[model samples]
Target: MGRVKVLGACPLDCPDACSWVVTVEDGKATGLRGNKDHPVTRGALCVKVNRYLEQVGSPDRLRYPLRRVGPKGSGRFERISWDEALDEIATRLTGIVAGFGAEAIWPFHGTGSLGYLQGLEGYPGRRMFNVLGASHHAATICSVAGGTGLRYTLGTSGGMDPEDFARSKLILLWGTNPLTSGHHLWKFVQDSGAYLVSIDPVRTKTSERCDEHIAPLPGTDAALALGLLHVIVSLGAQDERFIAEHTEGWPEFRDRITEFTPERTAAITGVPQEQIVALGERIARTRPTAIRASQGMQRHAGGGMALRVLACLPGVTGDWAIPGGGLHYSTSGHFRLDDAALVRDDLLPHPVRTLSMTRLGEALLETDDPPVKALFVIGANPVGSNPDQRRAIEGLSRDDLFTVVLEHFATDTVDYADIVLPATMQPEHLDVIAGYGHLYLVWNEPAVEPPGECLSTTETFRRLSHRLGLTEPALYDSDEELARQLLKGHDLDRLRADGFLKIQPGSVPADKLQFVSTRAELAGHDPLPDYTPPADKGDGLVLISAASHYFLNTSFGSNPELRRRAGDSTITLHPDDAAARDITDGAAVLVSNARGAFEAVAEVSDRVRPGVAATTKGRWAKFTDGATVNATIAERDSDYGGGAVFHDNRVEVRPR
Candidate 1:
């Protein structure tokens, strides 16, 4: 009879797992706002999420299951019943398994939802896929490279808590623009009243606000880090006691950095020698200095090495023993969830090959053992998110591939699907989320009923399990059961009563810091910190496909207001680079490389370095000219994990 409020959490692939409150009236969500009680959220939501109601109520919401009626990529479909769609999907999957084997079926997913029950790590379809002996999906498009790199030096990605940033004396924002992506972390950095330094090739919005901005040539972060460490050691500022007590292989790491003098580092990184010396001095003297190293910096060929070297900074300075000191690449390591229970990989028939999601094109087209015949897409849009857009689209266009997509809207990936199933959004689903930014476990209660025929991902997989004649009990577990299983040891009662709960008590332990890692050596890499320049360094301008302020990796690419605010698909260029090619501000230009090319409007500015060009990612093909910015990106792997090299490519930008 009246409006009521319900507690939930933002389920997007963001660091801030913001606890939010939804106002409901007549079983429909009327309004949503950030939870003021949450420390990181602080009663604020990002600009992109402020208009989320429109996204849920958009006219384009896919309300019913549909079957493709036209050729692939035609976006033509006819409405179909759930039974019909599931029966057809089951029939096709059975045929593919009979002919090519279960390895031919790829259940591709991504970070669209970070919910433990429905999102990337949750594995909503993992049980059925494991029971059928399906190939594993290596979700490496995001933080894997950095996480692996951090592991080399620290043994874990867990580092200084973001809440402890308020205790820091200095903070380094390395290749991250919190104003655009991790805004919640910014509040702590500001609260510390610490000297802020932004280290990035692009003079981002956050960089402009920093106390100092140090622009280095992209892909040379390891050299810069070593150079800084060299200066620290020369100044005799390294914590000898910390090195002797907590770290291993310090002698080798120290010797390795001896060659990375300020002059030598400047030559490689394009940062001025004087600035490097000054910043190095500052870092050496500053106590409890924290570095917020995000995923953006580790998206290159040598991404893992870069993070490894950077992580050594705190260990050298003995900052790891302080409240605010350490490197934070990710905080997911702190949450000890029951992963075995969540995915149930033990049910797999036998060992199956794992395919890299970063190299989706190769998995679908060039895979020889059993070529991918069926693709089940959930919580991701590859055409807009994956690198090598040309190859991914080509593979998706294959007529023989049986594709089924579960989505809220008809995305670029949906066009290539043989069957499109409408899936419930966050407000219509129950999930438990852990923030990679903060140390909180959030509970998301379903606020509204699913619109039209939309079903939750867990429900969809359960139906598929039944339709496939599978009798696995775990596969058919209810949402409540799955949640209870995932939250076995955690204080679920407090979390439900308060909407959130801190999973851990304090900052990372001092013993967690290690200067050198034998694990890296065992992996055939140098055990000590070092720099390796990217192999793709040619005489062309470097391309930086950075994140957008208004979109979360293609999740909000369809919002009209957000799109308008994002403006045209534009490439930002240095004034010198623009003048060299006779390109003017707001002029249409073409960015091309050996991989592929796309058109964009030019914005001549000094935001980027002379030899670098920048563009925001998440432009859908239909949003622009049938090609997204990813067309120019290669599907190359980083050194540690098979992470995509999104920022390691060289491209040519010219007037169209």
Candidate 2:
């Protein structure tokens, strides 16, 4: 590979799965940048992804397999051959299965590497483990509540394209900081000349740029949505024609929201009554308004209900029928790939137990009947990402438990692993990527080979299956075959040539909706969402583990350059709250609740609401003095999707 240009896609889990152009020189990639022809990414990359070439070839990259040679969590290991590592893993897993049954073994992974082959819905690794009858991972840490709840009203999470934002007169930047997370889409919103409104508990970068910033109380988004509906109903602005043609439960829903008046909504949410009335009027009067809902708002106890209510707003204004309208949660459903072809669930010997990845601490420490004895961790760093961090670490420290991790760097989770295997990056692997924000479908091809003994996630699983004596043909499926399966309707040769293709193609907006008649996807689900109060509330302040601009949930935290720019994991508090507690700005403080505690430097400012405290989450323990926000975060599940309630954390803060 000498001075060759290679087309690829970003494998990180994000709305904008950007397409990239990699410059390979002397058998290694020298430069990586966004593809100018790509529509959503628009020849630009985020702060974390812009330095992709540097990150892939970092000095600290794990290049070979290693076995623990010191105490657990000591970050000590001895180099080992891939064959020996796989053999030992196979032997230990077999023993665990023989003694504790298949349910005792769990495969832990996340969207850190979200390529179609290596991402969420498995191409081979999932099939191999399903054949082996390992515990089913609910993989609900992110996107669960937003996807599940939006479907309850819209029947599908797919909606108007981010490009459609150019046609809108109004936009709601709800619960998301698109400036950092979806930077590409933010340009479309800005160019559209739309009146942007931001709704969040703190004054985020998106909020600061908005024409109106509505700071609602944490977990009170459902109530605020209901209040908007109340004002719309009172003004008789409901789209009756669209309602008569497409909706069913409008009357019942109308009656239910009579209780949530604007005044009541103002009381529930911290926003003023006048602002609620004004915002509701804008929503009712605005044409082709798009509600850009994010997953953070739904990280509360009532996360599911909030999205359900937000999903129904488009129906009231008939926004679903227009360009730059309707709610955009995720466009992942638009791919319509042959999942059965990629994931061979039929190979399972029988149905196995399902474990929620959000409850890893409980699964490891509390489960009695065949507790998780063997765990294979990949594509995630649970010690830094999962809730109840202390408890999860305590469980990982158990002598009888065996843990395996595959990675490019020694993450906090790798510190406790019995066997650590070297893993390949996107530039050195093959996979496909689809956007949750745009209509593009990208194919990521290998640009360069792994430098050392590093291997792809799919190859690692195939090798392990071979060593375990698993003889399923499905376990040996090729990457190209799975890629062909996903690109069934499209022209394969053209897709390969372009390196990207639009999954949803249409000249009209209605083309996205599968059900023109608005109704819940599942039976027994409330067609009309109700206003639910906060689950955890008190006189004490609420702490939200907000996402940092440079780091995506424990994925890019290992990058030293990115870490330097992110600064420390400091907490921000309202001046009133800080004054009441006598806490000084920039001083180290304890953010604690009944369940757990963590330390953070406090920044006393009025940017946050009086009753709320906010801090950037996903900092690794090593950078933060063996501390993280997850230490205090409860393992509470969302209302419906079994999602982790990361924002449902309530704590009292005081200077140390």
Candidate 3:
């Protein structure tokens, strides 16, 4: 046996961008640990990183490319050679383009694979589609709403570094559970001397550790933010000089927020008037107060407005000038990947149709003249992640549509695929990752040759490009070359030598008080964060879905150990609400809404508000009994950001 080979950079589709030192003997991975030298992750990793070997070596992993031998959505396929697979895909896509024009073909992808080659950067999918003049999807499924809202208020959503948490005097965890979803960030928060406050519909693991937990009604975040602003202004906390100098439309914004008194906000948000007043006072009293807002708050009908309102808090108090005070969102800046440069339109033969990622099912099933004849899916699980699983299934089940899925395992999406291409595991590929939550761009070297016939996404695309005669020499370059291209203006040599790179921090202008007055404000929108309730609020209990630490969508759900760790999907309800519905803890209950229904074990607790219910997302589709959480969520979105309103749904629960 030789010395174990440690691999850095294993893609888990997570924001951590974890660097792993894989202990290998005789070409077999023995164990894994976090690379202490990695800049972003430091020496830490979540529980998932340790269990990656099991996932990579799982028996369920796809070993070879396979073509469907039975009906679509049926898990029946026969193994095919790489040549045959590439040939088949190329032929089908060409025919689709020739007949329906380039717009008829759609490439659906996201953060499934963190490597630049597989995602938006290195892949030719978007380039080909764009060159072909295919309809381009806006592609803002996750953070678009928050991004839009923040853009309007602050010009950008960027905030303080996670490491700077140690400097904060007051930390407001709004609609996020860093303890679970953001484990590493939680460590910084724990060590920080900051007084922690958690606000959400449910008392998450994060809330449990907080100094105070405020359970607000779902979808009322904007109202609460307005109330807080009202308190801050009323208590004379506003930086009037800064507000007058830096911001635009201040008079109108001030006039607008004057009506959002604590009493008025209490009724709208379901938070006690005293709690609102106390929180407002805390914000006013605390120096360098920081607010951490996540996607949770932006998954409602008026979610974008909520984020905009929350972002205005720090600015209103001139908190953005402080090292640890500001509204924080995504950390995608730590590892910068310029997508526009990678997309070359000259390579494609025609224009392609655009599709909405949010309406994946509808797009797939649409019977337009040319139709969505062919689909190329990479690094995403639309069936599991998209809203309305039943509709997604029906769309994928279309007999005439040809589908290709590149994955390591048989996901819910794979069952409907016409061709399943085996994909290399993270440790088996050479890649680079930049976290959206922290500052670090870590390089990952392959620990072992790709097992069996599996290939990396880059290799797959390269082979397909060669077969299609797309004469672009750059498309066939090595991963290293591609990485270099992707990191064009960035310092690649420094990143390589240091094992990570941190970008220079940008500054928020000194005079800007809030969204309306800041240069960072988004175009075609009011500068101040505004709020209005959704048009529809159904009768009965409101449903909200949150992320699960154990699973990333349905990927890790197949793992028995991970499944054991996650346990069964349970519906969380307030004790009083459960009793009123004649339900008890541990009892099987039926959760139904206008869209669909599902059954699960009920847990009654005071952690949640009386009118609301909560459940973790990323459970296996089969466990929902044909009804997933997205089914109940309305497809309607915030007008400004186009964010899905997952938390605005109203459902009823009954004893099953």
Largest lDDT belongs to which candidate?
A: 1
Residues 1-656 of candidate 1 have per-residue lDDT tens digits of: 57999989999988999999999998889999999999999889999888988999999999999999999999999999999999999999999999999999999998889999989878789999999999989999998888888877777778768898999999999999989997999899889999999999999999999999999988899999999998999999999998788788788788898999999999999999999999999999999999998898989988999988888888889998888888877789888889889899999999999989999998878987999999999899999999999999999999999999999888999999999999999899999999999999899999899889999999999999999999989899999989888888987878888999987734443354556677888989877777878868776799999999999999999998999999899999999999999999999999998888999999999989889999999878987888977998888899998988898989998899
Q: What is the lDDT of residue 234 in candidate 2?
A: 91
**TM-scores for every candidate against the unseen true structure:** 0.99, 0.96, 0.95
Candidates in descending TM-score order: 1, 2, 3
Ordering by lDDT = 1, 2, 3
Say which candidate scores most in TM-score.
1
- Error (Å) of candidate 1 at residue 268 is 0.3
Task: Kindly report which residue stretches of model 1 are placed more than 4 angstroms away from their true locations once superposed.
Answer: 505-512
Considering TM-score, which of the candidate structures 1 and 3 is the better prediction for this target? 1
- Give per-candidate clash totals: 0, 0, 30
Q: What's the C-alpha lDDT at position 190 in model 2?
A: 86
Q: Compose the digit string of candidate 2's lDDT tens values, residues 53-111.
A: 77788889999999999888998999999989999999998999899998898889877
lDDT of 3 by residue, 1-656 (tens): 78675657756656567776888888888878887876546677777667888998999889999999988766899999998998998888888878877677677775677666666334446554554566666565687787767666665566667777778899999999887776777767776789999998899989999999998888788999899989999999987776766666677788878989999999898899999999899898888988888877887777777877887787678787678887778766334466555665555565444567777777777648567777777877877787767787888998888889988888778889999999888778877777767767777778887788998887887778778887666666787787787788888877766566777555543234355644324355555567767555778888888888888756686788988988877999998999988999999998887777777899998888899898977776755565667766655656555666777778899998
Residue 311 of model 2, lDDT score:
76
Candidate 2 global TM-score: 0.96
Local error of candidate 1 at residue 414 (angstroms) = 0.6
